[model samples]
Target chain A: MQKRYCAIWFRYLLTDWLAIRKPELKDVPFVLAASEKNRIIIKAANQLAEKQGIIPGSTAADAKAVIPDLKVFDFIPGKAEKLLAAIGEWCIRYTPLIAVDAPDGLLLDISGCTHLWGGEKGYLQEILKRLKGKGYYVRGAIADTIGAAWAIARFGKEKAIIEPGGQTEALLKLPPAALRLDTAAVDRLHKLGFYTVQQFIGIKRSALRRRFGEQLLLRIDEALGTAAEHLQWIHPLHPYQERLPCLEPIQTATGIEIAIRNLLETLCNRLKSEGKGLRVAILRCYRVDGKLVGADIATGRPSCSVDHLFKLFALKIASIEPALGIELFTLEAPKVEDLMIDQEILWTPEGCGLESPQLAELLDKLANKIGAKNIQRYLPVESYWPERAYKPSLSLSETTTGKWRAGRPRPSLLLKKPERIEVTSLLPDNPPMLFIYKGEKHIIRKAEDAERIEPEWWLTQSPHRDYYLVEDEQGRRYWVFRSGHYDDADSQWYIHGFFA
Target chain B: MQASKASIIQQLQQKILSWQGFASPAAAETKRMGLGPLEDAFPNGVFPTGAIHEMLCPTREQGAATAGLLSGIVTALMKNGGVCLWISADRRLYPPALLSFNILPEQVIFIDVAREKDVLWAMEEALKCEGLAAVVAEVREVSFAQSRRLQLAVEDSKVTGFLLRTDLKKLTTTTCVARWQITHLPGALPDGLPGVGFPRWQVELLRVRNGNPGSWIFEWNNKGFVPVEEPLAETEQHLTRQVG
Candidate 1:
């Protein structure tokens, strides 16, 4: 099989995207500018701006003087690459192997895929027509090699498609810049009066490597099919996926449910047989209008239960909108894990602790309803500070490495942040006599001695806290602390928690 | 004639209790649940395990007090190395504090959801899991229908449920087996010591199905609940005066 590659280039990638978003800028001359070395330089310009002698790389001020009504917008960095990648993903409908050519293009390995659209000419036409319909000005070319396809897409003048074995002939007339050479190499070639690639096509490899560097020779060999070009091909889809093509588009929630149930039954059955379970599952619905809507569900632990997984998807089915009906449904489990077989409980009346199937299923339902992050299990950390005493565990089966600190009367309800309270103590070091919190006065009848605790030296630099357990007349206990030493003039008292 | 009439009334009461799904337990099977005389208030003189118990905590202080009392009960329920679920919109029950009531913090799972509806739903789902020893939910409000739903879930699974009602704006009737109110009581050290004493709360049974309602003072001594027989001199006088 002859490996044919296609490259599609966006002439004004950034400006075209901007015009599409704000259609009012369709006819206006505009340039996207960015501050380079503290000077605003145009990064991309529309065709109208280019026709009016305002080009990219010129200062914004200079471009403005040339056309006073020119619209200058801030150029967002990395916007072009993001647009190209998204376009490449959309192109997956045509071919499976797509690589993002950063800055302005995409490369598709359409080796065996072109026959699906009849032939190479039809494939190239279909892509260009669809992309142009989406408000993008695109030019595409097909060739035997990626290098040739890329060069012809951007710089070829005579023809867009190079014949299968005529890459050398195609490269004979194009400029040296068409070979994707750096500016210095191209400038050297132009200084030597070698205006076209045909002038240097017969040069010896060793001589070209010494003068123009290895990149020039390598590009030539890659273009003429003497060297293999490896591309970072994007993985098309997850390995564990099932697709359902609907005879009639699904318009109701019940129809969607049936589709999901059918998909899960197949997927879960395969997973169970493989002794594996899914941790995350996504259901993507392709509508008749070429738009896609998706719903995703995640479990706390690996799950292969069809009923349990269906219940999770059922919660999110209401959020999916099947406008004009869904033509296809695809279920993919991107994350999976080895599942332990069910442990039969023969005699033990009390079930397993956290690893029990029932507990995990219950948590999965809760997590799917709320979110997985909201469901938490905490383990004790060895710390004196109440706020730094515990951390969330990773999973249900995790155990604490350290013992929980006891012998200290910790508050049951600790406030998220300490609240300031107005206090009056009889002496500099004695506990407060009374405190007013939230505009309400409470007389302190009993107070405990202050327990001074210093902040962790490595974590923070702050004042030590002198905590006092004080009881009000109504028998309510509050955990209050003074910010600094009692003698410090700026010391403040804050109520930290409520003790039962 | 009086003896015969009293016996007839006792037999009729037993029949009514049986109708409401409260069967009298065998004498040997009724083990003391460490709640002391508080357990006697129940119909069969046993702390109901397979029922929903609703506790009202109107203020933060009361909420903390209820947390203490609930942890104490949970410790007894989870003595056989079972896990418990704690679901709330925003939980403030410090994990370390559970240590004081003889519970390993790791044995309890906390689910902090944003909406009360999710909290109730999670609570009901957790209650349906027989593997969990108990399920505690801190919800702002639960209607009669919602509470009844939770009660029905526990009826089949036989899992204990504790509904901590933080907001009492609409305290409608529900199918919960009991309603409780726990408030902080002043800590007292023996011989007038200077430090804070063990936790003490005035546990009150505001409502109970086919059971007597009463208030008692109990203290947690790091082992189990110890009912404080006598109140302090001043507060006792104050309480008597208010009652009179």
Candidate 2:
């Protein structure tokens, strides 16, 4: 296959990323700024900020002077590189061979992959349209070589592609800067009256190398397919695993516990050395009686703690019968990620909750003993929609997405589905004085004011719920709500949750 | 020769008393398990912590009463913020409701196993965890020998085990510290006013290997359980009908 290359340039990557998370900042003038020793310098500006004469490489003061009400944000370090690497990963959907072109670009080898998308033109259009829909300003070009594709994408004035073997002719029309030569060298050539690649094409290679260093000739060679360029493909993380063979076929529960502990130690050591942690593992015991037993352990956070892992495994050791005897044990970490630093111990041991690690160990034990789906921890999502107000997090160490906007108190236990109950109320909007739930009648001894939770008008068509915190005669607090208005005598009232 | 024989006899008697847990170590380790007046029947005014106790509820309707009684026991045992595990084939425990007894939801872990085999396997394993305050297991039937296995595990770990026998008909016999039955009773409204009242339970001690057995009426209000002098005497059918 030919080494066909495609380069994508994200011109306003930082600005676009900011706007994607915050849609209200689309037309507003904002700049992503980086502080260097107390000096705030603008790195990238949104489309509107650019139109207002704010550009990169200017100080925040200069940008604000241009537009007084400009909003500036602290640029997140390594965010651009991470985004480019992520795009390099996503580009695997286009072609298997791809690499990061750095700062704000991705390179993909699309030789045999173009036909799958109906030729290079449709492919380029599709890629551009998809990225544009994601709020990114992009320019893409495909050529026979990566150097040629990169030069043409950023500097070429013609079509996005050069005809086969016609790159040299196309290269002649573009300026010397298109070859990726240093800025100093390009300016020197401009002063020497050699402004375009066509002027240098007539000179001998040796003469050009002696007059202006070898870098100039190498750049030109690389751009015209005379020199080779390397591309690095993104690879996924491999699963971590370990296996152990027992010399003796043991049948006791104690023997199985020892085998599981040994397997955990070997697997966890490997994970720890790589600065990684495991979230899920499979421990399999093969009995000599021709039967196999396996137990799956999942942790609340990415952890490689051998002791904690061993305890979770010990809970299931009783299930392995070892009918005749067991001979082999294998442990594989199927889910792993970079280790995260949970908060340090700040509170007393007998505090409201356990320390993060202690809590993680406890959750892992519970999840292993019980079913995984029965446990959940929710973090607030940045939304006003009721259903989207919070999202179940995968790990306990995940940083909060946004501040949990406080309103009225929420119940600790919410029913899977709200159950409709029969309520007796004195006034139209008053709290229910008596209600029957699950066939038991509850009389409200005390009630708080009705807390109205209106639906997000732009997102849904559901009726508003007016919730009340009512204490039953047994002194158990319940969260009950009346759906919609009370003009009808039989309006639906539901028991939503129980307050601890 | 008579003095030598008498000394050997005294040594054997002391060893037997220690084995029967009538000596110093046993007396020091036994704790008052918050069984109100029931503690007076034991050798010391305490309930044994390193022993196995059984609570049998005959039908599904009585499961809630047993759970409520167990929640109070767990709260008392886990005074130092220790954890408790509940293992069963079908989990119907509403954990948030236990908060009424000052037992936080996070302090308890619930395990539901589909196989009867795994239920005992997990319970036996949990009983061996000295870190835990107590282990409550719900199984239909546990033979006397199986109870002995659970009892042996607790003896080493000093973890209290509650074997809640959901199927009460198989009351063959087991070597347990005591056996209890919790039945839901009609809660009396103060002055006969028409509203729901506190949780009232009729607790019966069916058998005790080494202590006296009797029955008591307990009223669980917000301030915890309080013994009532007179038991509520309504027919059982009337109470089941309200819940059904």
Candidate 3:
């Protein structure tokens, strides 16, 4: 069997960004116009404007004359590029092998992936249905070559053509502009009575090459798939997935737990079969009543054990509301790696290592049961102030130990915020003599001055602090401090943190 | 050899006697005994696993500190790899106190839902989740039908469930193995201590599966709740001093 290639073109309007910003003008006759010097440049004309006889590059004045009710808007280049990138990201769900065919299109290499959505026709139907649901008018095409697909999507008989092993025949019906040639070459071809690609192809190749140079032949060869063309396909960073389609919609917690276990079993089996372990897996539940609920868990290390994975899920299953009913369950291993499986040696002493996956599972369960933001790993910030020394991380995957800065002695528990204290002591540059905190006055029987640390002047406007380890009259010790230098105004007293 | 054998038998006998009062490491680690002997008489010698322990208190207007006492006990238990699932029906749980109690915000999962019906449903789901150490569910009133469902779910999962009943008037006839009425004790003044005064609670164990119901006063200490034993003896001394 001869090998054949197919290119899928995803065409989007260049001016869809503007349409999104002004949704009211979506179906209206609108033209994107730019002004250069004193002349108006028409960048793009929407389908509604095209039906009103306004074409791209027509002057703003000409478009108004052509259609008296035409809506003209200024063109924004950078904004449109950002919007296209966002659309490109959403398109990644269909195929990981996606490349931005700049300005207005996305090229997806759906060769082996089309089967995932049932086939080429089904895939196209799904894409069209989703885009239309989001209020977009799009055109798609699939052919044996990128050039042929591009031409078909732009100027084919019905705006979408599926040509299999007929790139030459497909291009013959398209206009010279469909070859993606410059405007001058298209006009030159038009003047030479070669209006259609078929006319150009019928002429002698050597004569055409001699007359129009080798560029024309290159374009023709590219459209015909005789020349080499390269497209960069994006590889997703992580790619392990398992999907479960429930015959009966699951509404109860028991039902969801069963589905979770089934999905985890399949996912772990796949991970083990591949000799790989998953580090992160996301469980997405599509509720039948239209709500979407997702639970994510990250292992400290790569793991493929079904029992361990289900334990992590057990901690999080309570947070997932089965809502009306869950119709589908999907588990995706977005992160994976080859794990080192160690064999136990008899009579050999094994060193204890932290079970990272267990810790990560614990954290994941807590985050799910409580809330994602509520459970965070504290990373030490490079600051001397106790309150500013630690920062919370959203995921436990971030290493919590090495990130801390050395040099400062940190308390195990730091107060969320500093408490103010009433201090009356005669100390110009030393520790306080008396202080009252939590409505109890404590006389300092003995005190030792530790260190006076100043804030980072370049980053913050906070004042310097003089810290003290003071023993109260009752024998209990406290860590207190006075804010700001004595020379600076508003040198007040505050109890910043506690050590227990 | 004969003397050694005799000593070994004596040690075995001692070990067997101690085993009668032996507590699981999980129980010891969670500070279960610190909450006083009244709770220790029940099954498991503490809050029985695989059963629903209900805490009833009047409305917030009536100064119910049920959540505070429950939080303290739950926080102590959380140290032993046990998670606390807090299910709230109407009121929002304060986050600051939950953090201070050493219950990592992530450890206390709060389900802020509407309607008592949904709260009961969520509670049943939480109780059935294995590996969870305990579940604290707050509801206005748990109907007899709902309580039966919860009892079955707890028994199946073998996880402890605390049903915090805010409505003290509408008591369900369905037995929940054990029920406690929690009331706030009067705050104490600082007694020459630099730190804040200790918290207190007056607890009345109204029901037990196979034990007698009684009331007790507990002082919240650094470790956990300590029983105020010999309350009459201490009160008599005060009365004599007042008469003198």
Q: Tell me the whole-model lDDT of each prediction, alpha carbons only.
A: 0.89, 0.76, 0.67
Q: Which stretches of candidate 3 lie over 4 Å from their true place?
A: A1-202, A205-259, A271-304, A315-355, A397-430, A434-441, A450-464, A483-500, B1-244
DockQ of each: 0.52, 0.12, 0.03
Candidate 3 clash figure, as a count: 0
TM-score for chain B of each model, two decimals: 0.91, 0.83, 0.75
Worst 10 residues of 3 chain A by lDDT: A348-357
Which scores higher on TM-score, 1 or 3? 1
Question: What's the TM for chain B in candidate 2?
Answer: 0.83
Q: Positional deviation of A124 in candidate 2, in angstroms?
A: 22
lDDT for position A15 in model 3:
54
Give me the candidate number with maximum TM-score: 1
- Tens digits of lDDT, candidate 1, B74-174: 99888888888999888788888888888888889999988878888888888888868889999888899999999899988888899999889999999
The CA lDDT at A252 in model 1 is 99
Expressed as tens digits, the lDDT of each residue in A1-500 for candidate 2 is 66788889898998999999999998899999999778898988988899888888889999888899999998998999889887777677888887887788888889888889899998999999999999999999988888788888888898898767777887888888888888898999999999788998789989998888999888888888989878777784545878889899978988888888888888888888998999898988888977888888888778988998888888887777888888888889888989986656666343123333654575577678756665444455666434466665444445563756445545544566788998999997788889998789988876678888888888788878888877665455677898888875545899877543
In model 1, pairs of residues that clash are none
Q: Where's the lowest-lDDT run of ten residues in candidate 2 chain A?
A: A347-356
